[model samples]
Target: MRIGELARRCNVSTRALRYYEEQQLLTPGRHPNGYRDYPESAVETVRRIRTLLDAGFNADTIRIVLPCLNGDDVDMCPQVAAAIRDTLHGIDEQLRDLETKRGRITALLAGRQL
Candidate 1:
Protein backbone atom coordinates (compact mmCIF):
# COMPACT_ATOMS: atom_id res chain seq x y z
CA MET A 1 0.00 0.00 0.00
CA ARG A 2 0.92 3.64 -0.27
CA ILE A 3 1.48 6.20 2.46
CA GLY A 4 -2.05 7.58 2.22
CA GLU A 5 -3.57 4.14 2.55
CA LEU A 6 -1.35 3.37 5.54
CA ALA A 7 -2.34 6.62 7.21
CA ARG A 8 -6.02 5.97 6.58
CA ARG A 9 -5.80 2.41 7.83
CA CYS A 10 -3.84 3.48 10.91
CA ASN A 11 -6.07 6.50 11.55
CA VAL A 12 -2.99 8.70 11.84
CA SER A 13 -2.00 11.65 9.74
CA THR A 14 0.42 11.41 6.84
CA ARG A 15 2.63 13.87 8.69
CA ALA A 16 2.73 11.51 11.61
CA LEU A 17 3.69 8.65 9.35
CA ARG A 18 6.44 10.77 7.92
CA TYR A 19 7.58 11.65 11.40
CA TYR A 20 7.67 7.96 12.25
CA GLU A 21 9.80 7.39 9.21
CA GLU A 22 12.10 10.23 10.21
CA GLN A 23 12.39 8.75 13.66
CA GLN A 24 13.57 5.52 11.97
CA LEU A 25 10.64 3.67 13.50
CA LEU A 26 8.73 2.91 10.32
CA THR A 27 10.56 1.89 7.18
CA PRO A 28 8.59 2.22 3.95
CA GLY A 29 10.16 1.67 0.57
CA ARG A 30 10.25 4.27 -2.17
CA HIS A 31 8.46 3.74 -5.46
CA PRO A 32 9.92 4.65 -8.85
CA ASN A 33 7.62 7.69 -8.86
CA GLY A 34 9.07 8.80 -5.49
CA TYR A 35 6.01 7.74 -3.53
CA ARG A 36 6.34 5.73 -0.35
CA ASP A 37 5.21 2.13 -0.50
CA TYR A 38 4.51 0.56 2.84
CA PRO A 39 3.99 -3.11 3.49
CA GLU A 40 0.61 -4.32 4.70
CA SER A 41 2.11 -5.11 8.09
CA ALA A 42 2.77 -1.40 8.57
CA VAL A 43 -0.83 -1.02 9.67
CA GLU A 44 -0.25 -3.06 12.81
CA THR A 45 3.19 -1.50 13.29
CA VAL A 46 1.66 1.96 13.32
CA ARG A 47 -0.91 0.87 15.87
CA ARG A 48 1.84 -0.50 18.09
CA ILE A 49 3.80 2.71 17.75
CA ARG A 50 0.79 4.75 18.83
CA THR A 51 0.20 2.49 21.80
CA LEU A 52 3.83 2.78 22.91
CA LEU A 53 3.82 6.54 22.47
CA ASP A 54 0.63 6.79 24.50
CA ALA A 55 2.35 4.79 27.24
CA GLY A 56 4.98 7.58 27.47
CA PHE A 57 7.65 5.75 25.53
CA ASN A 58 9.83 8.08 23.49
CA ALA A 59 10.63 7.41 19.86
CA ASP A 60 14.12 6.15 20.71
CA THR A 61 12.79 3.80 23.33
CA ILE A 62 10.04 2.62 21.04
CA ARG A 63 12.64 1.98 18.37
CA ILE A 64 14.56 -0.19 20.74
CA VAL A 65 11.50 -2.02 21.97
CA LEU A 66 9.64 -2.49 18.71
CA PRO A 67 11.50 -5.55 17.54
CA CYS A 68 11.09 -7.08 20.97
CA LEU A 69 7.33 -6.77 20.91
CA ASN A 70 5.44 -10.02 20.44
CA GLY A 71 1.72 -9.55 20.16
CA ASP A 72 0.51 -7.86 23.40
CA ASP A 73 3.67 -8.80 25.28
CA VAL A 74 7.14 -7.29 25.16
CA ASP A 75 10.08 -9.66 25.23
CA MET A 76 11.58 -7.64 28.07
CA CYS A 77 15.26 -7.81 27.36
CA PRO A 78 17.63 -6.40 30.00
CA GLN A 79 17.85 -3.04 28.33
CA VAL A 80 14.12 -2.74 27.87
CA ALA A 81 13.54 -3.77 31.48
CA ALA A 82 15.95 -1.12 32.66
CA ALA A 83 14.31 1.52 30.54
CA ILE A 84 10.86 0.63 31.84
CA ARG A 85 12.14 0.71 35.41
CA ASP A 86 13.62 4.16 34.81
CA THR A 87 10.39 5.44 33.32
CA LEU A 88 8.41 4.05 36.24
CA HIS A 89 10.74 5.74 38.69
CA GLY A 90 10.42 9.03 36.88
CA ILE A 91 6.64 8.77 36.93
CA ASP A 92 6.69 8.03 40.65
CA GLU A 93 8.82 11.09 41.31
CA GLN A 94 6.45 13.25 39.27
CA LEU A 95 3.48 11.88 41.20
CA ARG A 96 5.14 12.70 44.51
CA ASP A 97 5.92 16.23 43.35
CA LEU A 98 2.35 16.71 42.16
CA GLU A 99 1.02 15.46 45.48
CA THR A 100 3.20 17.93 47.34
CA LYS A 101 2.03 20.78 45.09
CA ARG A 102 -1.58 19.71 45.57
CA GLY A 103 -1.17 19.82 49.32
CA ARG A 104 0.38 23.30 49.15
CA ILE A 105 -2.42 24.57 46.93
CA THR A 106 -5.07 23.04 49.17
CA ALA A 107 -3.52 24.66 52.21
CA LEU A 108 -3.38 28.05 50.47
CA LEU A 109 -6.99 27.72 49.36
CA ALA A 110 -7.98 26.96 52.93
CA GLY A 111 -6.31 30.28 54.02
CA ARG A 112 -3.37 28.59 55.68
CA GLN A 113 -0.41 30.89 54.95
CA LEU A 114 2.00 27.98 54.64
Candidate 2:
Protein backbone atom coordinates (compact mmCIF):
# COMPACT_ATOMS: atom_id res chain seq x y z
CA MET A 1 0.00 0.00 0.00
CA ARG A 2 0.96 3.63 -0.44
CA ILE A 3 0.54 6.63 1.82
CA GLY A 4 -2.95 7.49 0.62
CA GLU A 5 -4.11 3.92 0.93
CA LEU A 6 -2.66 3.61 4.38
CA ALA A 7 -4.29 6.86 5.48
CA ARG A 8 -7.68 5.79 4.09
CA ARG A 9 -7.54 2.43 5.80
CA CYS A 10 -6.54 4.04 9.09
CA ASN A 11 -9.05 6.91 8.76
CA VAL A 12 -6.27 9.49 8.99
CA SER A 13 -5.03 12.08 6.52
CA THR A 14 -2.00 11.54 4.36
CA ARG A 15 -0.40 14.55 5.99
CA ALA A 16 -0.81 12.88 9.37
CA LEU A 17 0.87 9.76 8.08
CA ARG A 18 3.79 11.82 6.86
CA TYR A 19 3.98 13.56 10.21
CA TYR A 20 4.06 10.17 11.95
CA GLU A 21 6.96 9.16 9.78
CA GLU A 22 8.73 12.42 10.58
CA GLN A 23 8.19 11.70 14.27
CA GLN A 24 9.74 8.25 13.80
CA LEU A 25 6.46 6.63 14.75
CA LEU A 26 6.01 4.83 11.47
CA THR A 27 8.61 3.91 8.89
CA PRO A 28 7.45 3.01 5.40
CA GLY A 29 9.85 1.76 2.81
CA ARG A 30 10.67 3.84 -0.28
CA HIS A 31 9.55 2.61 -3.61
CA PRO A 32 11.82 2.29 -6.60
CA ASN A 33 10.41 5.55 -7.96
CA GLY A 34 10.84 7.24 -4.53
CA TYR A 35 7.22 6.96 -3.49
CA ARG A 36 6.39 5.55 -0.09
CA ASP A 37 5.62 1.84 0.13
CA TYR A 38 3.74 1.02 3.26
CA PRO A 39 3.34 -2.50 4.47
CA GLU A 40 -0.16 -3.78 5.13
CA SER A 41 0.47 -3.56 8.85
CA ALA A 42 0.85 0.21 8.64
CA VAL A 43 -2.89 0.58 9.03
CA GLU A 44 -2.90 -0.97 12.50
CA THR A 45 0.28 0.91 13.43
CA VAL A 46 -1.33 4.22 12.58
CA ARG A 47 -4.41 3.34 14.58
CA ARG A 48 -2.31 2.53 17.64
CA ILE A 49 -0.42 5.79 17.21
CA ARG A 50 -3.64 7.78 17.07
CA THR A 51 -5.02 5.94 20.09
CA LEU A 52 -1.95 6.83 22.15
CA LEU A 53 -2.13 10.45 21.03
CA ASP A 54 -5.77 10.58 22.09
CA ALA A 55 -4.78 9.19 25.51
CA GLY A 56 -2.70 12.35 26.26
CA PHE A 57 0.56 10.68 25.31
CA ASN A 58 3.08 12.86 23.52
CA ALA A 59 5.33 11.75 20.69
CA ASP A 60 8.24 10.99 23.00
CA THR A 61 6.06 8.96 25.37
CA ILE A 62 4.43 7.13 22.49
CA ARG A 63 7.82 6.33 21.01
CA ILE A 64 8.87 4.88 24.32
CA VAL A 65 5.65 3.02 25.07
CA LEU A 66 4.44 1.81 21.67
CA PRO A 67 7.10 -0.85 21.33
CA CYS A 68 6.07 -2.25 24.71
CA LEU A 69 2.38 -2.51 23.81
CA ASN A 70 1.14 -6.04 23.34
CA GLY A 71 -2.30 -7.38 24.14
CA ASP A 72 -3.08 -4.42 26.41
CA ASP A 73 0.06 -4.89 28.49
CA VAL A 74 1.37 -1.33 28.47
CA ASP A 75 2.71 -1.51 32.01
CA MET A 76 5.46 -3.78 30.78
CA CYS A 77 7.23 -0.60 29.81
CA PRO A 78 8.38 1.32 32.86
CA GLN A 79 8.11 4.53 30.86
CA VAL A 80 4.47 3.84 30.17
CA ALA A 81 3.86 3.23 33.85
CA ALA A 82 5.54 6.49 34.79
CA ALA A 83 3.66 8.47 32.18
CA ILE A 84 0.32 7.02 33.24
CA ARG A 85 1.09 7.70 36.90
CA ASP A 86 1.96 11.30 36.11
CA THR A 87 -1.20 11.83 34.06
CA LEU A 88 -3.32 10.32 36.82
CA HIS A 89 -1.69 12.51 39.43
CA GLY A 90 -2.43 15.60 37.33
CA ILE A 91 -6.04 14.56 36.97
CA ASP A 92 -6.34 14.03 40.70
CA GLU A 93 -5.05 17.54 41.41
CA GLN A 94 -7.44 19.04 38.87
CA LEU A 95 -10.33 17.17 40.44
CA ARG A 96 -9.43 18.49 43.89
CA ASP A 97 -9.37 22.10 42.61
CA LEU A 98 -12.69 21.65 40.85
CA GLU A 99 -14.21 20.24 44.01
CA THR A 100 -13.00 23.25 45.96
CA LYS A 101 -14.63 25.61 43.46
CA ARG A 102 -17.83 23.59 43.59
CA GLY A 103 -17.96 23.92 47.36
CA ARG A 104 -17.50 27.70 47.08
CA ILE A 105 -20.28 27.95 44.52
CA THR A 106 -22.57 25.84 46.68
CA ALA A 107 -21.92 28.02 49.71
CA LEU A 108 -22.68 31.19 47.69
CA LEU A 109 -25.90 29.67 46.41
CA ALA A 110 -26.96 28.94 50.02
CA GLY A 111 -26.28 32.61 51.06
CA ARG A 112 -23.75 31.38 53.60
CA GLN A 113 -21.35 33.80 55.28
CA LEU A 114 -17.76 33.24 54.15
Candidate 3:
Protein backbone atom coordinates (compact mmCIF):
# COMPACT_ATOMS: atom_id res chain seq x y z
CA MET A 1 0.00 0.00 0.00
CA ARG A 2 0.97 3.64 -0.33
CA ILE A 3 1.86 5.99 2.53
CA GLY A 4 -1.58 7.55 2.66
CA GLU A 5 -3.33 4.19 2.80
CA LEU A 6 -0.95 2.99 5.49
CA ALA A 7 -1.45 6.16 7.54
CA ARG A 8 -5.23 5.90 7.18
CA ARG A 9 -5.23 2.25 8.18
CA CYS A 10 -3.02 3.04 11.15
CA ASN A 11 -4.85 6.25 12.07
CA VAL A 12 -1.61 8.18 12.12
CA SER A 13 -0.69 11.24 10.11
CA THR A 14 1.51 10.97 7.06
CA ARG A 15 3.94 13.30 8.83
CA ALA A 16 4.18 10.85 11.70
CA LEU A 17 4.88 8.00 9.30
CA ARG A 18 7.55 10.10 7.65
CA TYR A 19 9.04 10.91 11.05
CA TYR A 20 9.06 7.22 11.89
CA GLU A 21 10.92 6.59 8.67
CA GLU A 22 13.36 9.37 9.49
CA GLN A 23 13.96 7.82 12.89
CA GLN A 24 14.59 4.43 11.27
CA LEU A 25 11.60 3.04 13.09
CA LEU A 26 9.61 2.37 9.92
CA THR A 27 10.97 1.80 6.45
CA PRO A 28 8.89 2.19 3.30
CA GLY A 29 9.95 1.31 -0.17
CA ARG A 30 10.08 3.99 -2.81
CA HIS A 31 8.12 3.75 -6.04
CA PRO A 32 9.38 4.85 -9.40
CA ASN A 33 7.16 7.87 -9.13
CA GLY A 34 8.82 8.78 -5.80
CA TYR A 35 5.90 7.69 -3.66
CA ARG A 36 6.39 5.61 -0.55
CA ASP A 37 5.14 2.05 -0.62
CA TYR A 38 4.59 0.48 2.74
CA PRO A 39 4.04 -3.18 3.38
CA GLU A 40 0.78 -4.51 4.84
CA SER A 41 2.58 -5.23 8.09
CA ALA A 42 3.25 -1.53 8.42
CA VAL A 43 -0.25 -1.07 9.78
CA GLU A 44 0.40 -3.44 12.66
CA THR A 45 3.84 -1.94 13.16
CA VAL A 46 2.38 1.52 13.54
CA ARG A 47 -0.16 0.21 16.04
CA ARG A 48 2.60 -1.33 18.11
CA ILE A 49 4.58 1.87 17.88
CA ARG A 50 1.62 3.85 19.14
CA THR A 51 1.15 1.48 22.03
CA LEU A 52 4.79 1.84 23.01
CA LEU A 53 4.70 5.63 22.70
CA ASP A 54 1.59 5.75 24.87
CA ALA A 55 3.55 3.76 27.46
CA GLY A 56 6.20 6.57 27.46
CA PHE A 57 8.85 4.90 25.33
CA ASN A 58 10.67 7.45 23.19
CA ALA A 59 11.60 6.89 19.60
CA ASP A 60 15.10 5.80 20.60
CA THR A 61 13.78 3.16 22.94
CA ILE A 62 11.19 2.06 20.41
CA ARG A 63 13.90 1.72 17.81
CA ILE A 64 15.86 -0.44 20.20
CA VAL A 65 12.98 -2.59 21.39
CA LEU A 66 10.73 -3.15 18.38
CA PRO A 67 12.80 -5.90 16.79
CA CYS A 68 12.86 -7.90 19.99
CA LEU A 69 9.10 -7.56 20.16
CA ASN A 70 8.42 -8.62 16.57
CA GLY A 71 8.75 -12.41 16.44
CA ASP A 72 6.62 -15.27 17.69
CA ASP A 73 9.38 -16.13 20.15
CA VAL A 74 8.55 -16.09 23.81
CA ASP A 75 12.04 -15.08 24.88
CA MET A 76 13.57 -11.63 24.58
CA CYS A 77 17.15 -10.55 24.10
CA PRO A 78 19.32 -9.57 27.07
CA GLN A 79 19.45 -6.02 25.77
CA VAL A 80 15.69 -5.85 25.75
CA ALA A 81 15.61 -7.06 29.33
CA ALA A 82 18.15 -4.43 30.29
CA ALA A 83 16.22 -1.65 28.62
CA ILE A 84 13.01 -2.73 30.36
CA ARG A 85 14.82 -2.85 33.66
CA ASP A 86 16.16 0.64 33.10
CA THR A 87 12.72 1.94 32.21
CA LEU A 88 11.28 0.31 35.33
CA HIS A 89 13.97 1.94 37.42
CA GLY A 90 13.10 5.32 35.95
CA ILE A 91 9.44 4.74 36.74
CA ASP A 92 10.29 3.77 40.28
CA GLU A 93 12.28 6.95 40.74
CA GLN A 94 9.42 9.03 39.39
CA LEU A 95 7.01 7.36 41.77
CA ARG A 96 9.28 8.07 44.67
CA ASP A 97 9.59 11.70 43.62
CA LEU A 98 5.82 12.02 43.37
CA GLU A 99 5.40 10.48 46.78
CA THR A 100 7.86 12.94 48.23
CA LYS A 101 6.05 15.82 46.57
CA ARG A 102 2.76 14.58 48.00
CA GLY A 103 4.26 14.42 51.45
CA ARG A 104 5.48 17.99 51.15
CA ILE A 105 2.04 19.15 50.04
CA THR A 106 0.41 17.30 52.90
CA ALA A 107 2.76 18.92 55.38
CA LEU A 108 2.03 22.34 53.90
CA LEU A 109 -1.68 21.67 54.21
CA ALA A 110 -1.14 20.70 57.86
CA GLY A 111 0.65 24.02 58.47
CA ARG A 112 3.99 22.35 59.03
CA GLN A 113 7.43 23.32 57.68
CA LEU A 114 9.10 21.29 54.96
Q: Which predicted model would earn the best TM-score?
A: 1
Q: What TM value does model 3 have?
A: 0.84
Which candidate comes out best when scored by lDDT?
1
Per-model lDDT: 0.92, 0.85, 0.86
Per-residue lDDT of candidate 1, residues 1-114 (tens digit):
999999889999999999999999999999999999999999999999999899888898889889899998989889989887877787899899999999999999999987
lDDT, candidate 2, 31-114, per-residue tens: 889999999888778889999899777787778878887756665666678876776787789899999999999999999855
Clashing pairs in 1: none
Ranking of predictions according to lDDT: 1, 3, 2
**lDDT score for candidate 1 against the true structure:** 0.92
In order of TM-score, best first, we have 1, 3, 2
> Where does candidate 3 clash, by residue pair?
none
TM-score to true structure, per model: 0.91, 0.75, 0.84
What lDDT is reached at residue 31 by model 1? Answer: 91
Each prediction's total of clashing residue pairs, residues at least 3 apart in sequence or on different chains, is: 0, 0, 0
